[model samples]
Target: MSMQQFAGGNERFIRRYEYDDSWVIAADVGLDEDDIDVDIVGSTAIIVADTGERVTETEFELPSAGDASIDIHNGVLTITIQK
Candidate 1:
């Protein structure tokens, strides 16, 4: 699961995209206050702090074939999937 926060028009839930080198998961994610961002880039997930920058991005790993799920709670974000 990955969490991100941006100072915008009263919008707490952030957006996340699961992608690979050649395809995108075509999904939007909502973030909460206690969510963590995981860098699942090619099978690597980590927790990162909220860097109040213009744009924040990381890579995501994809399974052989499955669906991706994004969870939104209290302005935090969490992503999960199975291989």
Candidate 2:
């Protein structure tokens, strides 16, 4: 698996990874489950976080269609797309 971190809006960085049967995406936006919102449509995943008074959003495209899951642990927001 390979991961790449790209500079995102509002000075945040989003990380993406590709696996054989899944795609993993993560970010360190310092938000919790109550503060974060995740939306998956078709092959696209959208992650948004409400950091106090500021909002940050990130978008990712998957290689194929799959079930999507989100987890926020230890300050990292992880999204997994499984086929």
Candidate 3:
């Protein structure tokens, strides 16, 4: 593999897409559910992961004041927002 392939920490930890009336975010959060915390303050969603070695925090603004549904599967954290 090329050295460039390992850029962005091997892969992007976050993926975001917009729907007609909503937005979806899928993130690679390898930590256990107990180590992950999500919170919506105003129009921003915050994600914090404590992986023993480090603490990673991510935040994104929601499209308007939408509602969000969050879940985790196979170490993937998914958030769907409805407008």
Higher-TM-score candidate of 1 and 2? 2
The candidate maximizing TM-score is 2
- For residues 12-40, could you state the per-residue lDDT of candidate 2 as single tens digits? 67888988888887778777788889888
- Model 3 CA deviation exceeding 4 Å by range: 1-10
Q: Go through the candidates in order and give each one's C-alpha lDDT.
A: 0.43, 0.79, 0.73
In model 2, the worst 10-residue window by lDDT is 56-65
lDDT of 1 at 61: 45
> Deviation in angstroms for 45 in model 2?
1.8
Which candidate model has the greater TM-score, 1 or 3? 3
Ranking by TM-score: 2, 3, 1
For lDDT, candidate 1 versus 2, the one ahead is 2
Ranking by lDDT: 2, 3, 1
State TM-scores per candidate. Answer: 0.29, 0.74, 0.70
Off by over 4 Å in 2: 55-58
In model 2, the number of clashes is 0
